[model samples]
Target: MSDTSERNQAVQIPQEAFDWYDAYAHGGMDRRTFMRKLGTLVAVGYSMSVLTSALLPNYALAEQVSFNDEDIIARYEVFDSPAGYGKGKGYLVKPATGAGRYPAVLVIHENRGLNPYVKDVARRLAKAGFLAFAPDALFPVGGYPGNDDEGRALQRELDKSKVQNDFVAAAKHLKSHALGNGKLGAVGFCFGGYMVNYLAAVDSDLLAAGVPFYGTPAPKALRNNIKAPLLVQLGELDERVNKTWPEYEQDLQANHVEYHMFMYQGAHHGFHNDSTSRFDKASAELAWQRTLAFFTKKLA
Candidate 1:
């Protein structure tokens, strides 16, 4: 079947199934329970295998820009994060043929650490003419474990504060890197989204721009600390994350933070991610276009 056919089939999945999957993805539900609950969808004519295949991420489809793309160079790099995790590692990508320093972007992954989707995002950023790095928070525990469930479990075992510090350190490292123009921007999804908000909150000097996709907002007190321009992308149906936005907007307005928020009409949480059924192509494309434009206006 064509990819479009598969996506249409995935769209036939019930909303309840997506909710169950989202709950499970975020750790609110265990795998056994998730699988069992998801199995209930079998009554609707979806075999368990088809349900799993349609709901889970297919990394093979995640790449919009190839690692070997002529426009960018990609590789692994390690950096020190003394205050956070001791040693941090990540995938770094940058313009292959550019001579001058480029504005750098730190790509923060979801709760599952530095997975392929996030790496692909780094490559996309590089192709757009920026130095991009995606640090693996699970590196201290042996890296992504080759699967998201295990990866999420590994991330949960780490000291949350240390992980946050690691990202903060990453932003600093890339901003000061020899190949960078000294301006730093960040983009993150899910847990990474929260981290982007956290980064902008704690460090005003490093991040010049930030795009947080449907992640939770920083605490009200910390929200006042943000000084970077923010382009917040949210899904209209993601109530779990959306409930936190009103006060967040008030805080941003009260503090005079430069930010714009767009709530995609029919998109759900994880809408920007194309590897799963939750991906909303139109919304994701529009959001990304806006994101790149915002970066150009602010970072370039």
Candidate 2:
């Protein structure tokens, strides 16, 4: 079958992606080059103009986020985790009003680590009256390397057990932080989204709500352990992630897990990250609104 025909199953990763990835991994190519090349690989057979246009905006991680630094108490903090792997670092942002405790939301970044866009996302969450923390999954490897390829490479070296612990610890800390009212929620995109799913499943008692954007859901084995409500946003064009949702949703329903899912029409993976041209603005905004409403309701 052609690669397109196997979309219902696992789509094969392109050799071009592997080539660029390898080059980037070995420091032979910069992040921009790798991403551009990877984009071409993703839309194999597409015209060069279309391919370049689709991926450039995404690599530009600093899109215009409305919230200014003054709007929030943005800072870098070293947090203690329950997992005890070691102290980890992350970006913490909250409303500048700084008057009293508020609901807390843990922001997990895409595979690229806690880049400017993800930090901007934390600011957005703060504007919505939640304390947001965007943890660098690569923190233990000396934090986000200021290079996407390097950051991704560092991220691959993490111990899976430690990775989960870091998030769990961050959630545990955020929920009980001096700025928290004991309610905690999480939002993650791409890789981070899947982590949010993992967080929801294992640390259900700590997480009140979770929003996973284009992320994989926790496996069925962990379904019964989920106590928090979930808001799953899916892009219609992302087959790999979409293929797993049906079964996961069935498990959620069977386990009586409180969950809601929305499929954005004619969207692709990473649609919520406006830094990418693949982003569907209308759908992204709608998804964000629903995320806020759901978190407010569930975490309240």
Candidate 3:
């Protein structure tokens, strides 16, 4: 690579993520597959190293939870997806010491399944006093299998409508859980963020609040169907997602939808994901804090 070429490459978000964002946003690919493609395209160099790091398991996902199991009652459970798509599996997390019903949060993961980072997000919610559950969107495909490429391939094969129904089912399950206080809220990142936007755009009685980080808007037609309050977070540097915001905002207002948005000046897509270089700790922390406040005010 020439000096100018190397400088340009270094200045951009990893070359690996160029197509990943659009693919994942459209529900066409997964993060693992993105990294794998990155590795293959750039045989040997710094690019290859980036690919390796991106695919590595983020075992140390959350700084707050520290993988501590005792703080919350965590387990795997099956939820029904009525679209004839079969059962859905997820990691259910709640305050271990809490007694009595608590507000429930549907924690949706990125395009990938319920990996460690997402599971830890659930734990973080648990710590904040919400009964959180992170569902594996790839459950029908034999689960995540700890491989991104495989996960993306499976994610692409999903029936979009049925998959959405599965997410709704997860919310319903949490709402009806004995540990739940009946109210429900949702939070999602990346692909999951789009899911959050989807839920908000749909007329679901099960959802009371939604927070989508760096996600696109719901389809233009569904804007009026939103009955729940939404706190949409955005990364200023994420052109793909941000580019649609203006039009989305107009539609939301025209429909009188209840929604709010926050954009971090220097943050890029996936800024809230702690596992990757894309993470912006300051912005992520602020977004999370705002989410907690939103859920507490709306769900509690």
Best by lDDT: 1
lDDT of 2 by residue, 127-226 (tens): 8888888888887767777766567777767787888888888878788889888888999997888988998888669788999998988766877788
lDDT of 3 by residue, 77-159 (tens): 99888773779999988898868598999998877677778888999999888999899988888898785556666787888
Off by over 4 Å in 2: 1-50, 56-61, 66-68, 82-84
Name the candidate, 1 or 2, with the larger lDDT value.
Answer: 1
Task: State residue 209's C-alpha deviation in candidate 2, in Å.
Answer: 0.8
- Candidate 3 has a TM-score of 0.84
Query: What TM-score would every model get versus the actual structure?
Result: 0.97, 0.82, 0.84
User: If candidate 3 were superposed on the true structure by all CA atoms, what would the RMSD be?
Assistant: 4.8
Q: List the residue pairs that clash in candidate 1.
A: none
> Which pairs of residues collide in model 3?
32-148
Worst 10 residues of 3 by lDDT: 2-11
CA RMSD per model (angstroms): 1.3, 7.0, 4.8
Ranking the candidates on lDDT from highest down gives: 1, 3, 2
Model 2: lowest-lDDT 10 consecutive positions: 2-11
Q: Write the number of the candidate with greater lDDT, choosing between 1 and 3.
A: 1
Q: Model 1, 197-293: lDDT tens per residue?
A: 9999997776999999998997777777889999999999888899999999998898899999999998989999988778999999999999999
